[model samples]
Target chain A: MNKINILDKVKSNVTNFFQPKGVFDKNFVKKPLIMYLIFGLLLLAIPFLQEQGYIQFYTMGVFGMIIIYTIVALGLNLLLGYSGLISLGTAGFIGFGAYGLPFFSNLLGLNFTGALIVTLLLSALIGALIGLFSLKVEGVYLAIATLFVGEIFLEIFRNVEWFTNGFSGVKFHYPHVILLFFQLRITVTSFILLVLSALIVIALGYIGFKKYKNKQKSKIEKKENRITKIKSRLLSIFKIALIILGLMLVLQIVLGEPLLTFVQSGNSITTTGFRGYLKLEEFDRNQTFRFISLILIASMFIIYNIVNSRTGRALMAMSRSEHAAQSMGISLMKYRLVAFITATVFATLAGTLYVSWFTSAYPDSWTLGFSLILIAVVVVGGYKSIFGMFLGALIIHGIPTFYLKEAFADINGLPFIFTGVLIIVVILFYPYGAIYLRHDIKRLYRYLKSKIIKFIHLIKQRIQKSNDSEVNEDE
Target chain B: MNKNTILEVKNLSMYFGGLKAVDDLSFEVFEKEIVGLIGPNGAGKTTVFNCITQFYKEDKGEIWFKNKDDEEINLNDIKVTKVINHGLVRTFQNIELVPDLSIIDNILIGAHNQFKSGILEHILTLPRARREEKELREKAHHVLEFLKLHYIKDMYVAGQPYGVLKKIEIARALMANPKMIILDEPAAGLNDVETDELAGLIRHIRDEFDITVILVEHDMGFVMDVCDRICAISFGKFLAMDTAEEIIKNKAVQEAYLGGDDFE
Candidate 1:
């Protein structure tokens, strides 16, 4: 009984000392904000690491690409991971952002801000339209429809010089900015975008208003006048804002007045005004990597917040069982559209970031192959994990391009073979994703810790035995 | 029983291809009543539950329900998700809780409709979202506490024992603050002791929440023990709607269960 008590006391002390919770045990790597910050910090440090001769300079560029794609994958996680909606039109819409920006800012003389706005609007509109068309079909059929959409975008990018500048690609120089805040370049082009967004938002608002109207009008038949009074005022104010926005857009396009573009530097490398003061001398890949790193981190924060909230629960519920979700008052159609559109929006933003780095848009880059690699990233990373998505991006994207190619420099075909085999092995072993490797890692850690403790106990016993013999010799 | 009808299913029918799963079935449930829907295996009891919950689309007839808002609305007109908005919630027969989520998180799903925060608010974890989350979390905890499930709230629904899983499903339905709850086989996999406790628990829930319950079960003793009224059906046709004693004494119910006096 005394021996057992001693052992129990020792065990309790050991457990108390090693307990991780509240001491980073709540989870260090799994903690949301810290993980994103670390991701951004590591990405930022890559350029410095390159300068220190630890990594190659080309690594900065690849890391930049990873950052951009990480942004896209984060959004795709919502659709693929949360709602379980498989969409293949990602490359198409991202290309839209990449091409749309240059098309508007370079060809049409819009500033950076205007170009981004137009690009975002165009991507959202097209995505929603496609979501509306394709989302009616469920499961693999939805994937097939989106596949068609992707192929169609690729064909359009190949054929239409107006959008993608054809095979030669669209090239334009982006002005160097201190923080994107200081020299926030505003650019032009694409009335269809501004009009489309205004129309869609107004249409949605109107529909909601009418639905509310019907509900209230039905609920309290006698209080019709009050309902009309409150609803009309809100709708009227909303419509007035829309009208004003419409008029301003018309003036900016038709009259050619610099209404919004504070810069108004029409396709000129040199700026002359307050905008000139905001411009930095140059922007290399290193700086771009850091900037895009911050961008990726910010998006990760947003996605994390979204995935932990009520909306996220609804999405998971829908993904797991549509019947239960529907019975719980989760409208499948609305959340699906939201997930799809949010995905496309993020893809477009990533495209915008990609163009910001490369200063060019190429049809060759935004292909079906790139889209599949994205899916592979989410799959390998663990669909439900945000941090795992980042790791997945690095592994899937970095292996084939950087490490594998470099290691097997002489063997031209080996990298592809190795990457394929590695992916298969990882998937086979960790069916959920590489993120699940943590479980095994923790188990190994515990086993090793116990082994070390046992060794210590043996050593202590040996020392005690030696002391006892020395005491006997002295006696 | 409350004199006012809470749910009126008039001539409800559902068909799958050429099969008439429910052919012109009708029933009524009153307020604050523990009602049992008993039928022989494949008598369309589950089909009726599905149709009432709007999980299955009906081919014919009207399902009028007095919602939590005290508004009598047709269940057919609204979306499936909207049924819960009207304060009607149901538990699945097969325990449909997402295994990935914790017990508390699973329960929060039923409160999905009560959340009024916008998408942006949710994405940002703004004050409104935070407030709603805190409030609902407390509510879920309260639900867990009521069901004696608080100790295991953090555990994932996966790998939980069958009895615990059933209790968790019930807790999830209760999170909606439902005016009416439809339970599909609440005692299917449960042992006798659990079933007996479940009978008391059901009565307690009806009394405490002041809500009506409609459960589909095959356990005749359980139904007889628990139900205020037992509605029997055979081949999608209404057999009898009466108290347990009357249902037991009824000849049609006897014939339906035991293959009539000829078998004897």
Candidate 2:
């Protein structure tokens, strides 16, 4: 009896651990939780292993890139998916920020800390202006207007020598902190720890979502209510755990010191007389990459809230039919402005990130051709889902360059060509992107399961009736 | 009628490239009164509603709307957004609930102006903004209850029955908390039972809320049973304006109906 009681208590506690609250109430389950936990542990081991020379340094770099792209993808999802504003100039916004942030850092000597703030504010201002103008023209015409903005910015970056460091590009130095009295030295291990901490900070966001879904499910008697509540809870907790695990795996790689082993590879031109590759001595001080990632995460959360708010609903109504929205006492122009402004804010922050990471501003980076890639990420990920964009970024930008670099290394621009092809496939086969695909697939599975259950219930009812009739005959 | 006058129109006119849609139309709607605007197709009944809502720019018109605070606003001077702010909102002939959004979400959108917290507040989700959001949701639920649409509150607007969609639209319009609601056609596509329910609902809306109601309906029975006064129009011109009994006896209105019946 004691053993049975202990087992029951353990089972209940385990179930409770997976239960989601608030928004995540609908999806808590066992399978998803296990998958996320395993995945997160694997990832968290990466950097430390790289440091110990067990994993490649490029893998960690790829992870960083994925984080950044995920942020951009989330932003685009709000503009295109939730609010129905199609923008093709996403890359331009991100690239502008990326290039702009680094350039500001170089010229002002404010280091990454000050430059990050300045870069975000400037991007927001520029984004607001662009949004204002785009609202005047809509549909294909608005796309053209944004296209022109990207093209114009690219031209300026290329031609303007002083602002963009010309075609050859500019270089930047990182900042260092030392104890005032003790003169204690700061190390690269500490920097990697900071990055790891950021990943954990980001993963905690799943907790918030889980809580929200659970709260909603508790209020309604929807048919799929209980199942959905379980699923949401499980998904969020699983995602969080998986993220932690993934970071730990990455840390293991970093501990092996993968970047330090680059000298052993065929790229030993550094020994002869080449400086193309980044030196570890200076790269450690540069926090632009991390700051960019942080900004992307912040902006995405804000955009998501705006898309679900009253203003977002009004924008969608306006998008459907201007005449009807007007009848409902919604000002069409006001709603249009809201969509434009929201999208532009995302674009500007993305641009600043680009400037900061590359330590240079280049016109070609913000071209329409480049910006279309960002749009493709949103499309491939699922335009309406922020989570989908994160997945899309991983598929389009992360995997191709990181895992498959060797296959296409000899071919010029093959990665981009592959991304373009993927975009086409996603648009045709999965118009909503990867996130919607997952949602639809899950919904279908649930529907099938419920049908089976109902059919079984009917059979049982018939059997019970027959048995009752037999009992009556015997009597 | 002096104290009763809530919305007064003088020589209201609207033209689309010399084709006068509303030609020198004039009318008055009183506080807490249910007024019906009935006419044949293209008789400019909808155009008057459009003009009042400022959906279309009028060629000429003077509209004075008296508020609860006893301030009279020149409706012509007020922009479309301000129309709602001034406590005047309208529904469409076709249900105009945001189709992709949930029924509850549609109602919340109608209450956009009521929640004055800006983008920053919403993004940060400040205490006051959250409080306002909670209150707004409660108000939306109340509106749904008033219209008997609370059951389908969580359902998406797509594929709903016409009568239900129509009620949902009314619920959404009420979210604006307007002093008066202009329903373009309350019972156009409803069955007998639904129409009866709609009539009861409209009366509840007026009596319980003490709000002015302007209905543009073709169903004469519904209009006669519910309206405090009736206005009949023909060829963008007003033929009769009086009590339901007076409208029924008016020779001008009878002739106008006869004239349109042959065309139909």
Candidate 3:
């Protein structure tokens, strides 16, 4: 009882320390803290839930779904938010990844790990080809062209049996990791995988926070110290690389038995079920299932990194004005292709994760409905805000699975009705998304401050003029 | 005088279906001379600049530029992208800088060719790309310092005045390290004092950089002050080309000006 209270108190204090100050406060919610705290809490809470037996069934399902959609959102953000390219073919790209996974993993005799990487590269190559057209046209034309491409991809997937095994779909199986005399099964259980990936998502969120804040600070400062600029950029990249390495190491350790014999019977132990054996009834034993979440998380990290880089800024510039971007001598096609390719890579990998988890792949797995949900997430979450998109994925994809599906089903049009309501509410009330509402409120406060400054300036000017008039009269 | 000419236009014409905007225009700027292109409103003064810059494809005739290593190249045959490589840079009549990009970034865009760093280097954030980026930034800083625009190095083009933006455009054009610069109405929006400052800047750029400057201006006062030689054109035909003093006294030049009737 005492231990639980102490833990609760520590959590509360940590939250208080990082929580944003009042909207009116000038130094409210430093980005780094906000980013770390939000994701950190989510990570901590997951393991805690597993201890209480309250984190089964849909927890893994919902988390897995969120990871998938988050990847999709990351890709779409590159298109709509960064590269100024509007795409309606997200479902098609995701379907490509899903369908491609089976061919590489089963038919080609490639392991699950090999198949995932191959799927990502293939999707990126194809996406770059399709995204090439964005250079020639823009607005409705580019949108329609991409939409057509998506439709064509779907048609190909549905008709082609050899590659995708037709409309029925193909099941996935794990391959053993060969290491000298010892054989290691690379299959990952759901609970351990989710926890490990949740930790990674948290770490990535931290890295993203550091990057975004550093960028914002540099922009505001203008006259940045040159050494600091070089240092910060290098440090930011180094930190990202370090975090990725750490996540990979953790995945490797957790995948092998006897991974953790030291931990007490606490929340972490309950969540991982790692006691030198696969005897934990509460957690999954399939190594592939565990790895799917981790792999998806890793893909999410790549997406986040791309979104935070200089190329990302170029994407944003292109999105705002293609003519201006081109006039400045930026290769419009190169950046557009990069954005599309990056986005497709994320969706493809996410689809791979989805397939690996369920041991199945199909053309209809990521459909128009799935694409619409991703678009909704991007719009409602806030376009261009990567962490916000992840948060949005959690709320939109996670909540619907846990609580809102019944309410959605009870309605006549089901999920579409909720989506419609969400759009109207978002567009009308919070046009910038829930994350930006805090920013907007802060902007309003700044506006009020500027007005006050202007008023004070006017008064000072009046006083000075009056004093000057009196001096002239006296003279 | 025609023997050492750096650029020569011959019978250049442009038409938009029925409207002959530029008809049979011809002129030449001598090597190292600061030349002025002057004309009444709608007399295709800027159209000639656009033609030379290859921003417009002429319907007729040829535009020639004397290249380094002494080769005569046809400007009309060259694409806009190749024009910069030919050591000719142009500033627009209206400033067009990327608003979201910083002033230094705007200048660096003009210096795109300076860094021969490959796409792989840019992507991997390799040492060469990093060093090249820093070098380009330093060059931009130096140019901005020379122009006295160092204070706004980090500022975007939006929220700046028309005059400052114009200077930014000039600074950007200079980044290409052109052998010649074509400036369109550099003193248009500036007041008398600012115009005087600009006059000095024009002469300084020409003398210090050893680059030929070709200017188009409706501000006759400025044209008379800064131009080493002046050319007056009317109806896409060259009326006069001489020292500013001689062009001011030329009968054809006077007639083209007063012939408009609207001019006093």
Candidate 4:
């Protein structure tokens, strides 16, 4: 009787444990902010961990590239996912940025900041021009137009030997970091810290502001007295300011030295009748990883915020029905321009970063194949999800170039075959992208778990019966 | 034109190749009135609506609209997107709500023009943008409440019942705060009960929102019941424009619907 009681108790305990509580619950595991922070911290530790010989430099480099691709994917996601614009000229914008950076730095003799600003402006102008075409054409025709534009850009890069150096490409000295009257050479670590710290500040500020607003709204809902409302608002503002200040202090402690050094350095030089002193930074692979990761995080946050905004809603509506969207007072041309410009700027930034990382800009690299891969990344990642696109980039670009090249070195076309198969599988099973795979996996796990529990219960019943028989025999 | 006339179409004609989808069709929509465009299948009721809204540019004729600012503007001179800015908006015959977006988000799209903040403000989540967004959300909630669709505020439009989807579409149009709304076949797929509910809702929208409603519906019962004025058409030509009772008794409308002596 005791044995039977024990078996029942065990079975009930197992069932109780699996009854959708604690970690088993979806809400508990789906805290986006917590997950993001953890992921961010992990990314921060990667460079240090690599330096300690825990991870190889090659691996870090590949990871860094993956982070860059994630930024590109996020940018593309803004267009493809939110705006419903399928662009095949992503490579063209990237090439323009890549080539434009060198042009600005070498010919215009501008610093990194100036070069980036100029490149972005030029890319926006070009993007706007391309956006105009979207007004006239859409879907497959727009795709073709973008493709043609990309090819034109490639041709310009290849033929303009004076600027792009033709097939040979243009190689220029790294742009210096200039501040006030000081110039300091930048290391990869400092650059990473600089970018990451800025992103952290923006993200935290935005989130903090949002939380404060929600609190204030709730307070208003409670019908708090006006005086009390004012007092609480001031108090909340003070608290937020203090928190932001504290965060800044912490970042300063971590990254203050590099910034100080950058400001204090008095490295001077004169070039071609120009007298300007600037910091020259040597960017290494690890810094590349850190920088790209920073960009990825920042872009992800921005895109997330945008999608939740009115502009995002308009773009989504436009995608579903142009006629309906127009009826809603959405200016199709304006929103399309915004989406196109944003995508172009992001691609341009990625291109500029790529050139800096490799210390070379290649026309051949920015081809139709590159653009197609980006499209595949957005599609396979689940066109609507930012994080999904990140994974999509890793799968589509990172895996083929890093892992497959190493694993199947003898197999000339293995990467292509593998990517095709993977894309097909993802499309077939998770048409939404791998982001939705979590739900499917959870469902599968639940089914298997229930079956296992039943099997265990059946075994326990058998054991209890056997024990009872033995007791009966002894008696 | 009457002092309250919000829209006037003069000899509006649209042609697809040699086929004239809408030819020499003219009508006027007055303030706070429900006008029905009734026609048989292939009579170009939708085409006429499209021409009025400038979805398809008429090869001939003028669309004159009295905008919210009290300016009489030629709608034909402007693009389709600008028509809504003039306080004129429309709903599709087939419901066109963004399937993936929540009902609130879908309605929020209609508030795009009302947003005071620009792209930069939205991207940075500036105070003004947040304030605008909050106000829009409140307005959307109010609309949903008014339409009795607050239950489905968070629900996606995908696979929703035809009645609910039609209501959502109208809800979206209402969110635009338009002076006039053009609903194409608002009760197309609804049953008798649903159609009656829709007719009541359409009247409520016109009265409560203080907007002119132009609807193209095939259901004679629905049209007669809801419409203040009925415009009957056949083969892209205006048959008659009169009160619902007068339209029901019109000989040309009867012939158009029941066939002429040639058929007998």
Query: Can you write out model 2's per-residue Cα lDDT over A386-473, one digit (the tens) per residue?
Result: 6676688888887678756677898878876886677677778887677667767889999999999999999999999999999999
- lDDT tens string, model 1, A51-100? 89998777777877877878899989998988888888889878888888
| A171 Cα displacement, candidate 3 (Å) | 3.3
TM-score of the second chain in candidate 4 = 0.95
Model 4 chain A: ten consecutive residues of lowest lDDT:
A256-265
Q: Taking the tens digit of each residue's C-alpha lDDT, what string does model 2 give over B7-30?
A: 998888888887888888898988
Candidate 4 segments exceeding 4 Å error: A1-37, A172-284, A410-416, A455-467, B11-26, B59-64, B69-74, B261-264
Question: Which candidate do you rate higher for DockQ, 1 or 3?
Answer: 1
Cα lDDT tens digits, model 1, B1-264, are 124899999998888998888889888999999899988888999999899888898999999998877788899998777788888999988888888888999999989888889888776565567779867987898899899999989999899989999999899899998999999999999999999999999999999999899999978789889899989898888889999988878899889867886322
For all candidates, state DockQ relative to the true structure: 0.38, 0.31, 0.13, 0.54
Relative to the true structure, how large is the alpha-carbon lDDT of every model?
0.81, 0.70, 0.70, 0.79
Q: lDDT tens digits, residues A1-475, model 3? A: 5445444444443333323332224444445434444454554455446657887855765676676787788778878766667877888888887778778766666545556667888888888887776668778887788778778878888888887777888776443332111223334575688789977776675665456455644453332334345555775688567666555534543463434333324233333344443322212423444444444445445555454334654565566554334433456667878887877887787777676666677777655667777887888888767677776786576665666676666675566456467667766887766567777888999999999999999999999999999999999
**TM-score of candidate 3 chain B vs. the reference:** 0.93
lDDT of 1 at B183: 94
- lDDT of candidate 1 vs native? 0.81
- As for model 2, its CA RMSD to the true structure in angstroms is 12.2
